[model samples]
Structure formats: structure tokens, C-alpha cells
Target: MITAPITLSQALDRVARERPQAQAFVAPGERHDWRAMREQSQRIARALHAAGVRHGDHVGVLLGNSGVWVQIFYACAMLGAVTVPVNTRFKTEELEFCLKQSNVKVLLTADIFLGIDFLELLTQVEPALASAGGLPGERLPCLRQVVVLGERCPAGAQAWDAFLAAGDAVDDAQLQACIEAVAPDDVLLIQYTSGTTSFPKGVMLTHANMLTNAWAVAQRIGVSADDRYFSIRPYFHVAGTTLSILVSLMTGCCLLTLPKFDVADALQMLDAERCTLTSGNDTIFLMLMGHPDFDRSRIHLRGGWAAAGPQVMQKIRDVMGVPGMCNAYGQSEASPNITLSSFDDPFSLRAAGWALPHPGMQVRIVDPGTGSPVPVGEAGEIQARGWSVMKGYYNMPEATARALGADGWLSTGDLGEMDADGRMRMVGRLKDMFRVGGENVAPAEVEEVLHAHPAVRMAQVVGVPDARLGEVPAAFVLLKDGQDSTAAELTAWCKSRCANYKVPRYVAVVDSFENIGMTGSSKVQKNKLRAHAVALFGLEQPA
Candidate 1:
């Protein structure tokens, strides 16, 4: 029987007691067994306590995926402090917004990682931090201490060693008391949304919310203590926090961490470590399979999950030799996992992109216009209510009210369809849907058809202004290696496969959307694609 953990501290302690000597975390040159994980995280908790972090206090973690990140996360949990993860891809403005909005008291960051200098970025955010000796300025008044991990510690920031030693005087009994005070309903994380359409909002999640959701995912994926899980998801994202890190901790599985995603390094690590499970999006899976170094025989993967369409899911099973791969669907506000196909599910259902809702989550497809539940097999907005729903958006009551109803159902603002058996499949975002001479068209539905093309590797579609039709579909495509397709031919292919209104009126062949329309998590930014399409096609901006 799978007993769900209420608090993260309880989960950590349970796993530590059950698998004392088993490996819990593994990276290139580092390893932390279950016993060490408990000890190390407790030590960090002591240090954080000495730094004056208390229950409900917000602490920011600005580092890559490493043992240190895991230790810090658990330490904050031990103290009942909320963790606000700073995205590595954030610029000066974005980083400052996160720190200021979350009211972070202490920040732990790295000097340099993957050729990016975090110190330089921090200096841009606050010029006085370089000379104020960890003192806060007007811009960041709540920030009391800046802890630097690398050798080049700034003038005002505390060094890693000194920070760790600061809590040597803190007793174990005091730390235990703090841990005991933590409740299941206490907010543990304030995850920021990806901001594809608007400024990012902080999604407040409690211990019970994330822990139960992670347990559901682990159960569905058949995760066990013996499984070696390889995940390239960034630690800053909710998927990394709940699905990867928390899942491994709860299941006593060994988590394989990568500071950054590189095709060569990922391929080599998967083969060498004999990883049994993995996770990624459609773009990530495509990049791995398209790489010349990818050898199916060398890969020992048995099962995993993906946020992909039917075309990509089919390739993951048939081409990549992962027959147990399942399709996944969710957003940050739902603790990320609303529905996921079980590893034991039939391949046909998995390939068709059908997924069963997490055991405790209640899912409904509702009309975006009237808030009425849609019939099964009809497309509508996806809303969920249960243990996985977020508490609210932090400090944004109006936005919170808009997303969450009084009855506790969260309006996901995503388009999807459900079948008679309670299986769900994502269609597209409600905001991404475009009207074509009165007919509604979902870009995802059209993009899926484009993905079926032999030469097309990836496709992104947007609604561009048309004089005759108000708006029409425009597509940007990335072709497979050594393959060629013109705009006209691709348009013809889509025209033959889709309805007249659904087919893209204009198609542009592109080499890559790397920095142009991609997010840090590999999701396409449809809003940006729309802006780009207008400029490239010389379409007039809507009034």
C-alpha cells in the first residue's frame, strides 16, 4: 500500500529510515545516500534557522540542479519556510521581480554555472549589495543575507563555508521543534508561472498539495526504490520540484541530476548509469532522438512519462524502444500532474494521448463562456479541484480570484477533451485558440497534423490578421535533418489533412526556434510566435 506523506519533513524522514544506505541522489561526480540526505538537509536547516528563517518566511534558491539545491529545499521544509526558486534564464528585471515579489529574506546562489555568471546578474539587480556587506537597500528591503557558493564571493555576501558554520551553535532539539511545528496545510512553495501570456504570478502550494500529487505520479509510473530516474527538467520548474525531486524522495529512487541539458552528456549518462525511467517534453524527446549519439541498444530505459502529442508519443515508444512511456498533462497551478497515462496502460491508449486523472484530483471540462461542464468527447476548458489545487496566487488576490473559484475549482485556462472512461487529452490553451471567420481553431490540433508530416520535425502555429477573415492560421516549421519541404508543399499537406478553416494560410520554413519562440522548459511561446508572424508576413496589427 502507498501511504501518502502529509509533510515533506515526514516524507524525508520516512525514506531515510527505510532506505538508510541506499543511494538517493547521483550526479556526475557526487552521490548522496538516503542517510546522508537526511543528515545534510538537517544541517542546512540548522544553518537556515541561525540565519533567522522562521515559519512562513520566504527564502530564494538561485542555483542549478545539484545536491546543494536538494539539501536547501529540504532544509527550508524542516523550518517550515517557503522556497521561491529563481529561474536561471531570468534576466536582471525578471530576477529582481521574483526576489522582490516573494519578499525573499535570504538568497543562496552560485557564482557561475554553465558559463553564466550569477554574481554579475545579482550585481545588476542591486548595485549596493556589492559593498553593503549583505545589507539590504530600498529595492530589496527584506533581503538580509546573500549566500554565495563559488569562490568569488562578493563583498556583501556570505561565503558558503561561513554560512554552513554559522549554525554550529544551533542545537538539534531546536531544529526538531521547528520541524514539528510544520503542518500539512502550510505553504511550502511559491512557484512562479512561466509567463507565456502575461507577467508571471506566484502559485502558492502547500506540503499536502505537492506531496500527494508527487505520490500519485510515482504510483502511476511504477516508481520503486530500485529505479534509477533520469530527469533533465530544470529544478526551478514545479515539474522538477514535485514530479522529479519529491517523487524520488518518496519512492526511495535514485535521482540522476544534470546541471543543464546537453544531448551528448544526457545520452552518455543514460547508458552508463542504466537509468530505468526518464521524463521530458516533446521538444526534449525530439532533440535526444535526432542526435547522432543516440543508440537505442545502449539505452536501458524501461518506462517514463512525457508531455507530448500522439505523434511524438508514438515515436518515443516505437522508435526509442520505450514501450512503457506514458503521456502526461498538467500546469503549475495543479501541482503539475492532473492526468498521466499509467505505465501499464495499453500502448494504443498511450499513443492516442489519453491519460487518466490522478486518483484524488477531480477533473471537468467546462465551457469557457458559461462555466458549464461540457459533455464527454467535447472540447472545453480544463478545471481541476482536489488535493493538487494550489492555495492561491501569492499577494495577487484579484488574479487568484480569477484563477480559483470560491468552491475551490481552479480554472486552468487550458483547452482539452475527455472521454467516457474519464480519460483526458489536451487540445491547446484557451488564449491560444483563434477564431477564423467565426469558427474556433485550436493551434495544437493543427500543429499535431503538421507534426505528422514526414519532413516536419516541429511546428508552431499562430493567428495572424487577415483582411477577409479577421484572422487566419500561420505556421512556422522546423524540418527534420537532411529533409526539405517548401511552404507551398507543407500548406498542401495540411490542406489535404485538415478542414479549410483549420489549415494554415501561410507557412514559413525555419531552421530553429531556439531563442526565438522557446521557453526555458522547451514549451513554445505562442504569444511570441503570433508577434513574429505579424512582422514576417507584413500583416497589419489589429486595432
Candidate 2:
């Protein structure tokens, strides 16, 4: 079946026209019907176009996961502009790198978030933009304007409402025309991968790519208009952006959003809203388990089993009173989810599950050395071919080519085994990366965070063996001349900056790091570091 090319905004309009009085977006005390959301998105689109944003132009959204995030995403879709959502946890330097790399012309952000003033950071980075002044605004090179969301507009930033006043009101006809102009192959969003290095690579996702993934998820989760989706993941990530926001909009489901993840608050919302379907990374599941109000009676899954350890699963059933749970697996490069355990399968809760049977999506296990397909029940590299595969990394052709083969299959770089029953069990990563409590703790991502410490001159991170978690991050640091900071101090600093799981469990101060081998780019060889961590921490062999 050939699906029609429907831009995100068009999807919202359809829902509004069909379910005008139906509740759409819910957050705190705020609620918007489908019709209201559609009109607001149109107004925002007009406001964006008036600020000089156009088709294919990058519009940076640096806000948290709030109702405004949905507005910005749909508004950009309505205008055919590519949205670039930046991670809210990023430091000033990290934020600057993403903004400069994407060549974002317009930025929409909040004045303050998590006790940090984003406006002050923007001002500090403004002078550095002088090096690249070919774009319209010399002040920020490609950045021509900034829209401050919420009530207070920061100094040197334009009020969001003021910008909306200059543009003509947009109607359904205008939105429909814009949707007609948007081809399925057009780039929809530039999602930045949380790479370990100083710079992040933008994963270019096409409209078809995202739509296919969302459709697959809807099918797996049995999404419908009656489903209420609680969006706890950050909108900057694929899990929240495509799976939560885009999927809800496309499937005509109601979306409940949270600006931040708070276990107590989330439980209250789930109970009050009676959320039927909730999805997030493993960390979210763990957080839910920790809440005092966590009980199976509070949750109502449609047909899937909630994935967790047996003890956690029992708690969910006993406390929240949910019947079933299922495990899900995917990566940013795969537009997020490729496989989900089924509620009907006997081992569904134990395994990562099976790939959804979407059109043009294929999964195979191949021996890494010989590039030959591995037999069933044997571990090998997991490769996939699907409409959900990303178009490529933005402006990084070499990396793109290496990731996606000429045969159209994308090597996931993840090692897994397919059982006789066709269920896939992930073994480990072909790369040196490892997961810390379900989050992809790339040694590089942690190492970069360590290097940011004022007392540290250089640092390296690697996954070490853990008794409970499969692996935990460990760090080796070299202090600057005459500077001294205890391992506890450094670890505490990282905790303040990044997620808790990303903090190093063990730290050591080293005088020098032996350069065993260097890449063509002169980056330190991470394999050597991994080996050292294994030797020092005595990592256990995989059974």
C-alpha cells in the first residue's frame, strides 16, 4: 500500500478536523484540543517564516520537553523547515558546537532551565561566531534570530509573541499546500548523536524514515485515538521526537508531556491522566520502579508485556497492576526502535524481542570476520535493511558510507544472536562501547565529560565489569600541572553535569597514557583503553 505523503502538520490538521473537540496535548494544568493545537502550530509556523526561516533551513529548538516543544516541531514541519533539537543538558561549549555545525539560522529556547541561564551562554558564544560571517546575521554567523519561549524574553532575544505579530495568519489551505510540497524523501530533522568526542554528528532522518518507524511502533504497541501517550523522554532524542510526538500526532493519540523527568510527578500524572501507553528508554523504566507510588494497578498496557527483571516485573504487577510488559530495542541510527518483544511470546519479556514486520525492513545476523550470515542460535553482528534507516549522517559521507552498505543494509555495530524461534538476543557491541544501567555509556561520552573538569588536563573512560549492571564506566585521569583534585571530587563534578549512570564508578589518577595506536585523525585508540580497563578492573568474560 502506497501511503500518502503527509507532513507532520498535515497529520495534526487531519486529527483536528476529524476530532475537533478531542483533547490533544496535556501538560500540568494546560490542555489543548486537536483544533487548538493545529491553529497554534499554524500561528507559530507563520511566526517562523516571518523570521526568515524557509524550506530546508535549519531551525534550532533548544527548549526542554514542554508543550512548546511540540508547537515548535509542528510549526517547523508546517513551514517545511528542518528542526534541529539540541540536548538541554549540554554545556555551553557543547551547545555552541551543535549550533555552529548545523548552521542554524533561527534558535528558539527558554530563558532559564535547570538553574542555568541559556541566554548568558548564547551571549558568551556570540563573539566566536565572527569567524564564520558569510550568513545573514554577523552576530551569530548563520543565526539570524532567537525566540525566547515562555513569558520572560531574555535580553537580546525577541519575544515569541512579538515575532508572531509580524506574520500573516496561516490557514488550513496554506498548511495543505505546504504538505503537498513536502516530498517523503525530504530531510525532516537533524538529530545529533550523543557521541563521545567534542563534536556530535547529525543523523539526517527523512520523512519516510521517521514515518516508517512511527508506523511500525504504532503497530507493535497497538496505538489508537483512545491511547494517551506520556512523553517523559527529551524531545531532542528520537524516542521522544518520533516515537512519542510524531507517532501520537500520526496515530491521532493524545500526548501528555513533562518538561522534566520526576518520578513522583510522573506517577501522579499517570494516575490522574490514566495514560494507557507509555514508552521510554530503560533508565525511565528503572526510575519508575523507584517511585513510592509504583504499582501495577496504576498502569494499563494495551497488549504488551512490560520488560524488566523478574523482581521489577512482579513489583509492576503487584503495585501498578499492569498485566504484561515487553522489552524494546533500537538505536538512534535506526530511527530508534527496530524490535519489540511481543506479549504473546513465552520468552518475550526475557529477550529483546523480534523485529516488527514493516515493509522493506530486514534483519540478519552475520559473522563479523567473514561477512557471512550466522546460523540461527549463533551470535553475530546485527544488520538491518529498512525504510526506517537514516538517510545518512549530515555532511559526513565517509561515515555514512561506512555505516550503510551498497546493498542498502545498515550494519548496526551491535552483536546479537537469533534463536531458532526468530527472537533476537543482543550479546554486546562490536565497538568498545557498553551500557551502564541500560543507557549507552560510550566510553568517549564519559571521557569527554571528565576532560571538562578544571583540574583534569586529559582523561579516558572505559567499561569495566560490574556485579549488578552488565558494565559500569571507569575513568583514568591526568591532572594539570600543580592542580590536584581527588577522585571523589571529580566524580561529584560529573554527577552534577550528566546523568547519574554516566558517572564513573572507579577513578584513577595516571601520570601518562601510552599511545598504543592512533587513528588517521590522530585520536587516541579507544581499544587500548578498553583493554587497560579490563585488566585493571578484572572484567568478567561473557558467558
| Best candidate, TM-score | 1
The numbered model that scores best in lDDT is 1
lDDT of each: 0.90, 0.72
lDDT of 2 at 314: 41
Model 1 CA lDDT for position 302: 89
The digit string of per-residue lDDT tens for model 2 on 337-455 reads: 76766545454343334444345567889987877998998878888887778888888899899889999888888777787766675555678667876777656456656755657
What is the alpha-carbon lDDT for the whole of candidate 1?
A: 0.90
Off by over 4 Å in 2: 1-5, 128-140, 150-155, 169-176, 196-198, 300-320, 347-357, 432-543
On residues 1-543, what C-alpha lDDT tens digit does candidate 1 reach at each position?
246448999999999999999999998789999999999999999999998999999999999999989999999999999999988888898888999999999999999988899999988897767895556877788898889999999888999999999988899899999999999999999999887787799999999888888888998899999999999898889889998999998899999978988889999999999999999998888888877788999889988889988888888887789979888889999998999999999998887778888876799999999999999999999999988999999999999999999999999989999999999888888888899999999888898899889888888899999988899999999888788999999999998999999999989998888657667787888889888889899999767
State the number of backbone clashes in model 2. 16
